[model samples]
Target: MAEARRMPSETAPAGLRERKKEETRRLLREGAARLFAERGFEGTTVADIAACANVSVRTFFRYFDSKEALLLPDGIKVFAHVEDALAGRPADEEPLDAVCNALLAAAEPFAASTLTALGHPLEDIENVVTGRLVQAFSAFEERLTVLVRRRLPADTPDADLRAAVIAGAALSTVRAVLRTRRARRASGMTETGPAPLPRAFEILREIGSAGRP
Candidate 1:
């Protein structure tokens, strides 16, 4: 019988390799963002991103399946924030109100947060990053709609679907408003106020609450 292959020993070297992989991924993502911002997403090539990150083209592929994935950055964190918000709703809160509240809270970080406030102008990066963010968010809307449906009472008629639709619409509206605000600020409109996330949630709650009675 052939001898069994010895498994690699579990040790410090293995830990170091994992850490190195994470660092490489972070570097690649940052480099790709810089290039995409500078050259436009359609104009930038994977090889260019690799060169920026100081890694081989093959290594770029290892970190990101494709250039599109590079635009998404860390999805796990976004989803986790959403989940956490949902988990924190008050027991007395209506389902739709709870969801709206959760989404409003979860989305705050992205709306006029430091990332959008201090970074390169998003309007300039629309071709590469902003456009992709919109598409990804549209998909997220569909997923959230399904999640609403799953969480609804069995006898609930349009409430589930309506909540999901409103949730998506609300998020889309908020994003559009924020984009315009960012653009205005870039053009020297220095006194932009907070994005209308809370108002959007209020609208969603109003529509959803009507179904309760």
Candidate 2:
């Protein structure tokens, strides 16, 4: 029998190749973060990241197009994962809880984001990238709002506004978690796993209920 094609684009079983690609991506991201932290942006070259990950500079480009690209959030994979997870959520689950849990399900890779792991303040990032982050997050809010709307009752009062607020609040909670990551890493501390996320949702629930009765 002929050797099965192992390319990621090939139709044959490529599980091992895909895993290797994923692992390579993770290593490059981690290497980029470490170097960016130690040397700042301009000082950290693509060659340096490749060297850190034990790959050729050519291989680095195959993964990330550029150093700046490495610093951006993993929005595409995250959005897709969140969408699928939300679809899998139980129909009877509360809207907020379903959304929260779905977001949490997509948290691991996101929470370990390279730029976030660097723990730099917003002001420290370039103005162009900072603007891009703002744009990216607005898009994130819109997507999350759509998911939130689906879980809400059809007869929800001021349905659009309510759903938007729920989505905004959920996105804010995620932002809080990422910000906490920056702060903790800056202070030489470590993350508290997903504990902060649920705790944030708990606080939001308290505030929401406080106005109810």
Candidate 3:
């Protein structure tokens, strides 16, 4: 009989391999962003991005489906952070406040970076990039709904509808802030910095309170 194969120990090199893979993905993402910004999205090719990152074309495919995916990393990170924040909120916190605070916490680091990624002044971003970003945020709405539902009683009437409404309002508030901030910067009315996330949450709180009996 053939000898049984020995299983790899938990202390094997898996962690190192995973770290290297993540590093490669980061390089590809950063390289693509720089190239796309310098040469316009349509003008930049997968091969060009791979060359910029010092990786093979196959490696790029292993990391992202297309160049469009590079614009999405920050958005994906934001939603993940929001999910974690909501999961950790105090049980007694009001539902809308929980959602608002969660999103505000998640957005703090990315606020300025997000605007920079889209292009400073924001108006310079290509239509294709904007469309892709909208698609990403739409997917995030579904995730937000899941988080909001967690804050409500399991058997609450109209729980899903409530969650949906809250999620929609939260996302709409963020989008409005982005547009307003960008316009302000473009018009030379304000210096670029973190988006008014606290103010957005305050507005959300007021809206929620006003809607109640």
> TM-scores across all candidates?
0.64, 0.61, 0.69
Q: What is candidate 3's lDDT per residue for 20-132, written digit by digit as tens?
A: 99999878877877876687777889999999989999989888887776765556775777788888999989788888777777654454454476464233443344445
Which is the better candidate, 1 or 3, if ranked by TM-score?
3
Off by over 4 Å in 2: 1-43, 47-68, 71-73, 112-138, 188-194
lDDT of 2: 0.72
Regions more than 4 Å wrong, model 3: 1-4, 9-20, 30-45, 56-58, 71-76, 111-135, 191-195, 211-213
* Candidate 1 vs candidate 3, lDDT winner: 3
Candidate numbers, best TM-score first, in rank order? 3, 1, 2
Question: Which candidate comes out best when scored by TM-score?
Answer: 3
Q: How many residue pairs clash in each candidate?
A: 0, 0, 0
* lDDT tens readout by residue for model 1, 1-213: 123333334465788899999989878878876776677666788899899888999988888878766655455666667767777877656666666677677654643342352255554453334444455455577666766665666687787667676557656765674565456656876643444667655655576568685
- State each model's CA lDDT, in order: 0.65, 0.72, 0.72
